[model samples]
Target chain A: MLVIEGLLKRYPDGFEALKGVDVTIEDGELVALIGPSGAGKSTLIRCVNRLVEPTEGTIELNELELTTLNRAGLRRARRRMAMIFQNYALVERLTVMENVLSGRLGSVGFFKSLFRRFPQDDVDNAFALLEKVGLEGLHDRRADALSGGQQQRVGIARALMQDPDILLVDEPTASLDPRTARQVMGLLADLCEEHGLAAIINIHDVPLARDYTDRILGLKAGELVFDGPPEELTDDVLPEIYGGEDWSKEPSEDDEEEEDIRSSGQFLAEEVL
Target chain B: MPVEQREDTVVWRRRDKRQAVIHWFVTLGIAAVVLWCFKLIADDTTWEFVWSAPEQGADLAIRMFLPEWFVDIPQLWRDGELWVHVAEYFRQRGLYAMELWDPLVDTIHIATLGTVLGVMIASPLAFLAARNTTPSTTFVRPIALALLVTSRSVNSLIWALLLVVIIGPGMLAGIIAIALRSVGFCGKLLYEAIEEIDENTRDAVKSTGASGMQVLTFGVIPQIAPAFAGISIYRWDINIREATILGLVGAGGIGMALQSAIDTLAWGQVSVIFLAILATVVLSEWVSAKARAAVT
Candidate 1:
């Protein structure tokens, strides 16, 4: 179970990313957060673990309020929450199994992990998690060598290795092909069912979200535009959330085809002056 | 458009300040060269100091400091002393000969121990130094920079001198000298490595409710391991050379005998020792390359 009430965050540049948005998820529920790009979807999920700190909000995750917890306390709380990244942020040099075991880093000491002296139980559990995600024999495989689909599967296994009570999946299928995306979504749905884990999946594809999740929470411009069962998600509501009168006018063509944006490292570092 | 027009259209532009900085350096270099030439002609300094035995060391030192021991010169070169003296040294310090065992092993052991120890100290310091990784550039970065400066400010010789006072005369001194130098080097390298890791990986770890320590270990360390290996191994090669020379300060290894041979102006013995040191360094370099390759 999770509770987020009046979660708000504003950028230093004065742009509000999450403007008093609120939502809650019951235990073992497969929920999809559908929105256009920059809909505060990512920001909402990021704030749950305090990755993007809220300007003013109380995020009650488990018993402790995330906004009030100190760094150590937050880390302890984080062990119960796992996030799947859009980019499948696997450590490139580490093997697939090693990357998965990193999910347990919060519970282990710095020296133990550094020296590869992790508890045998954690290692055994990591292998089991990998096997469940269909990467059974690829334990020793380098994370960078895997295909995008395989990497996402490993990402899932890594999150699952945490034995997370709540899963925050941000654009889990954003990079995969339609078939692979469906498979990833199905894998997530199945895991939530089997493990009784609450999951919030942020997705761009409306059709995919409708088909995959039992419930839908729609966001538009840092506001909860809609929240209801998937059956009630109508085309009339889509226009209000996405701002397109006709199918031809909709931005669906540009849906997942956003070009890879590589910001210049030199530009990011130094001031122009 | 014509080719000329196309070429003109593609004219490269430099940022004004960058161009000005480069121009300033060039102008300063030219002015210094002209002043030096003018002074040479005006002063009419004798060319004798360049070739004279007594003044050669001073002149070379002026160009760039030569070892103080090199001040003594025989004014002649011969192969018999070289042959007799070198054969004698090789036979006397059989432990130091290229074909023999202990000295070479000692050199590598010092280098390996120094590199590993330096990395252990520098790894955490690097995190504090990296502007992107550190929470406060004002607080953590200065401490990190101080560590780098302290490590690098004195060369391995000073470290050897210092260690000789504390630990006293042995491989410990050599190892300490190498480690101190490595701290400076690995700090700069690993900080850069830490800065270059993908932010997405960091964000992924942070979202897990992981602490700053967790982010560094799970997210940053895994990313930097290859680069860290490459840098440490590169320093490993440098330490091999430094370790041999460390004995000049009465630390340990082949340098003790090397300084003796050089002090006596026995070129043949010096030549033999130098060649042996060169071979040892080359072999270590090859091994370092293999180790780095395996890691990366």
Candidate 2:
């Protein structure tokens, strides 16, 4: 379980990115964090991993306080949680196998990792995760040689290699197309289910978030406004979280086109499973 | 204002009248200064010698081309020798060929060793100088940058002169000079490359809970590997050319041969030495180009 109590982040310029937010997540729960741009969705997830350090309050993962750990202690804490990025941040020149094996860097000695020598079990696990993510035969290829969707799959494989308790994903599908986005999300959902892993995914697409995740948390201007199951995230609640937009408006032609794409995305998601 | 209203339609001029006038005056001032500098140079030049330069150059070229491959051609001619002079010419050529090989080999060794040593020294300094990789920007980076600048400010020839005096004339002096000069060139470029690496990729690696050194190996090094390779090869190519001249300062290479030939007025031997240096430089250039292309 992960618990955040009064988590606050105020930048040096005195901009409050997270305003005393509190939340708790149980194991096996895959939750979606939705907000408009600059609503602290990214900030909140980063704070959990201490990537963006919190100025005040506490973040506890499995009852271990994260905010006050020293350098070595933080590394130990970080091993229990993994982060995925929007850009699929693979070392572009490195081979896929190397990139995946890098996830075990914290566990290995410096010289062993430096010489590209990972333990055989780590290598075997990397191969297994590569196969699990459907990148079965491209392990020798450089990261930049893969397509964006393929790269994101490699990113997922790398994160899974960490064997972490929680996955902090920051806009994983933001750079992907609609179909590929749903497929990647579906893969994450399936993997989380199999491992009973807790995850906080920051997603922009409302329908996709609602489809894949069990729960949704809405942030608006550094404050948590709504936290509920996906079924309870109604149109009335959206205006409160997203602010003053007409929730009951008639669907436009563009909305109908989007509906078609979403339906096709759903089909692709099912195929991924 | 750059945007103004004219009658009904709005008029947009890139520069208003005041800016245009300022620009024009600036151009005129630069032109006047250039003309004055040209006049100063013209006044100081001796035109009489300048006019005779072509004839002097042609005479020197003629002397240089007539290589001294034969050891006493005039004496052989005076004694009424025919086939004997030809045999003597072949013998002298053979002897000269034997003399040239060692120094040419020495020059190659100097450059190769110098480049390796320089890269070994520069790689660590590059990390210290790079803003992203340095342990402290204010304290560590400035010292590293100062070292790089000091290395770069002095030319390899000057370095060779100092080393020859201090270390006693040999290949060691030539190697150290080349390595010192290369430290700055390699460090500056390597640091710039490091600063431009993809930070997002590094962040991802750090998020894996890797140690600082591990993050450097996995996150930073791979991104800068190609740039490092290209810099090393490019520096080696330049060092090959520089190594030839180091022998002039008693740092052992083909340059020592050239200096002795010039001192004895053996223009032909000087020409041959020049040709050998040219060939070595061209070969190194080609090799460096191919190596850099392969890495990139």
Candidate 3:
């Protein structure tokens, strides 16, 4: 289980990216964080990992108090939580196998990693994870040579290679097409179920999040305004999260496909409720 | 739409006439300055000597090619043992063809060793100078930048001269000079490469709970490897050229031989040394190109 209390992130320049926020997440649950741009979803996720340190907060993962750990302690704590980036941030010049194996960096000694002499088991596990993510036979290929979806698959494989207890994903599908986005979301959901690993995904696509995740946390302007099951995230609640946007309007021509998905998701949510 | 079009037209028409006048005045001022500089040079120069320069160059070329010893080559070749006669001729002129072999080898060693040393020193300095990797921006960055600037400001020739004075003239001085001169060049390029690495990749590595050193080795080094290899090879190519000339300051290399040849007006030997230098430079260029291609 992961618990965050009174989380605050005020930048050195006096901008608060995350206000006092509190949340608790159980293991084996997939939670989606939904908000408009600059709503602090990314900041919240980053603070959990101490990538962006909290100004004032207590983040307890399993039983470890993450905020109070020193640098070395923080790194050790970070090993249990893997992060996936929006950009599929595999080192583009490195081979796929190398990028996947880099997940063991926190566990491996410095000289061992520097020389790329990862233990046989680590190498085998990396290969296995790559196969699990459906990137088999691509171990020798460079990361940049893969397409966007393929690269994200590699990103997923790398995250899993850490054997993390919890996954923090930031806008994982933001750069992918809709079909690919759904596929990635489904993959993340399946992985979470199979491994019993808790995941918090920050996403912009509300319909996808509603359809896929077990719970949704809606953030608005650095504060969590709503947190509930997908059915409770009604159209009226969206305005609070996205700052007074008209949710009942007809879809524009450019957003026709997304509108269909939204309507279908709403129908599914009503049926489940 | 019509109102917007009219506003656009009015804005285009509202040109400043004084701007054009200022432009013309600036142009005329630049031209006047250029002509004055030209007049100053022309007034002090001898036009007659300049006009005769081509003829003088041709005369020197002819004399260089028509030395008495070179003219006797054909006559000597008429004898049966041409190879032996040629060897004897070189022996008689005190130019034993083999005398330059050690100096040539020393030049290559100086360049290779210098490049290795320079890259070794530059690599750490580059990380310090790179904004993303520096330990402290205020404390370390300025010192690293000052070192880079000071090394780059002085030319390799000047470095060789200074090192010769300090270290006393030898191949060691030449090697140190080349290494010192190359550090700034390699450091500047390497730090820029380090700074330009993808932030996302770095963050990904960091998020894996990797320590700072681990992040650099796994994330940063891989991205910058190609740039590092290319820069090192290119610097080595340049160092070969600079190493050859370092011998001119009594630091040991082919330049020492060339300097001696010039001091005695041994133009034939000077030509030989020039050809050797050209060959060495071409070889270094080829090697550098091949290495860069292989790396990238």
Docking class of 3: medium
> What would the per-residue lDDT of candidate 3 be over residues B76-169, giving only the tens digit for each residue?
6786556776666567445634688899999999999999999999999999999999999999999998999888889989999999999899
After TM-score superposition, the amount by which residue A3's alpha carbon in candidate 3 deviates from its true location, in angstroms, is: 2.1
Candidate 1 stretches with Cα past 4 Å from truth are A62-64, A104-131, A228-239, A242-246, A249-273, B1-46, B50-109, B131-138, B161-171, B202-217
Q: What are the lDDT scores of the predictions, listed in order?
A: 0.80, 0.89, 0.88
Give the alpha carbon lDDT tens digit for every residue of A161-265 in model 3.
899999999999989987788899999999989999999999888788888899999888899999999999888887777765556664433566655555633
DockQ scores for all the models shown?
0.53, 0.80, 0.77
Arrange candidates by lDDT, highest first: which order?
Answer: 2, 3, 1
In terms of lDDT, the poorest run of 10 residues in model 3 chain B is B1-10
Give lDDT tens digits, candidate 1, residues B183-238. 99999989998999998888776765566777877788788888988998899888
Total clashes in model 2, counting residue pairs 3 or more apart in sequence or in different chains: 0
Instruction: Extract clashing residue pairs from model 3.
Output: none
Model 2: residues with Cα > 4 Å off, grouped in runs: A247-259, A263-273, B1-13, B67-98
Give the lowest summed-lDDT range of ten residues in model 2 chain B. Answer: B64-73
Q: For candidate 2, lDDT tens digit of each residue in A27-81?
A: 9899999887888999999888787899999999999999999999999988889
Clash pairs for candidate 2 = none
